[model samples]
Target: MPPPSDGTRHLAPAKVNLTLHVTGRRADGRHDLDSLVAFADLGDVLHVSPGDALTIDGPFANGVPVDDRNLIRRALAAAGTTRAVDLDKRLPHPAGLGGGSSDAAAALRAVGADLGLDALMALGADLPVCLAAAPSRMRGAGERVDPVALPRLHAVLVNPGVAVPTGAVFAALEGHGPPMPDVLPAGDPLDWLGGMRNDLQAPATGVASVIADVLAALTAAGARLSRMSGSGATCFGLFPDPAAAEAAARRLDYPGWWARACTLNPSAP
Candidate 1:
């Protein structure tokens, strides 16, 4: 059955990369990466109505573009249909949280169109996994998304309100590092995660120094594992449980910083 005539609403969950490995650069000048991806309950909201317009409003709406340049618009174009889209922009822009790409994914899904793989990739490298909205292994500059059953995790996401362009971070990278093992070690997820790394962290830090500070704060607040997500200005702290993650987030009183506790793998049956 098709969705209601009025349209459908979808959640654009935050996409987090637990580990990111820059394998190498391609001849086309695009970098190849291998990343373990998971989604958080925290994110923006998109509502699609039977019309051909887009309206964006919410706390972080001002930070995003509303025109064709906006990823949502591009996604709608890719889906080959026009719908009245109301985006409740909650996530910070360019925080390394994949907010825009996730929103675009949600929009494309809500349109109920069959935009093939090639079309989706043209929107953004991260759009494919965001469309899956599940724990997955992302490879080949984000074309391959293989679903994995990841344990639910309690995490606190922190962004220092700095926008680090993806291009600049890649430019700052010294060189490609060793890729992670094909299959992560079988053990406690947190332990396995600690042994991995976001290769872009150092270069990203050079672009946004506050990323290091965010990691330190998460650690001081008792996070078991704290690290930058993707080519970040945003980082995450993994906790033992939800209560602990919430408490840690509440204790963070940094001015001009955004922090929130949310659960990973929160999809409903």
Candidate 2:
């Protein structure tokens, strides 16, 4: 059955890479990544209605393109469907939060487009996992996504209001690092996660020095573990509990910085 003509709302949660290890570089120039990915409670929202127009509005919607260049449009085209979309762009772009890809995936679901994994991936590397919108292990230039069991986690996400180009960060990578262990530890996820690393963090910090400051602030705010997410300026701090995470988010005082406390692997609404 087709969705009602009024509209349908979809959540586009933020994608957080808790552990990102660059294992190798593929012949196609894409890096092979071994990472544990998760979704946060907070993210953008999309409302899709039956039409062919696309409209965007939200705090971060000022500069986003609305034409065919936008991922939402491309996704609709790829699915052989069209819909009027109103995107509430909450997350900052190019912040390693996978905002655009998540929005694209939401559009596909809104129109009931069942483009398979391969077709979805062709739209973007992160599309597969964003479509799943669940905790998973991602590998091989993001072509592999295996859902994993993960407990709900309290975390604070921060963005330093700076752009770190993905290409520049990858170009700065000194060398590929080893992949994560074949099996994750059975005990505390935080303990195991603390030992893991985001291979792109160093190079990304090099690209934007402010990232180091964000990590330091997160650690100082009593985060159990702190790390940069994806390729850039956004970082996450895992807290012991919701109260601690919320407190830390409140304590992080920096001009022009964005911070919010959220739960990872939260139940779908």
Best by lDDT: 2
- The models' CA-based lDDT, in order, is 0.87, 0.90
Q: What is the TM-score of each candidate against the true structure?
A: 0.95, 0.95
Single out the weakest 10-residue window by summed lDDT for candidate 2. Answer: 1-10
Candidate 1 displacement at residue 232 in angstroms = 1.1
Local accuracy of candidate 2 as per-residue lDDT tens digits, 1-269 = 11223458788899999999999998889999999999997888898878988889998998899988899999999998889999999998889999999999888878778988888888899999888889999999898999888888999999999989999999999888889998887889999998899999999999899999999999999998999999978999999899999999999857899999999987622
User: Distance (Å) between predicted and true CA of 143, model 1?
Assistant: 0.7
Off by over 4 Å in 2: 1-7
Give the TM-score comparing model 1 with the true structure, all chains together. Answer: 0.95
Extract clashing residue pairs from model 1.
Answer: none
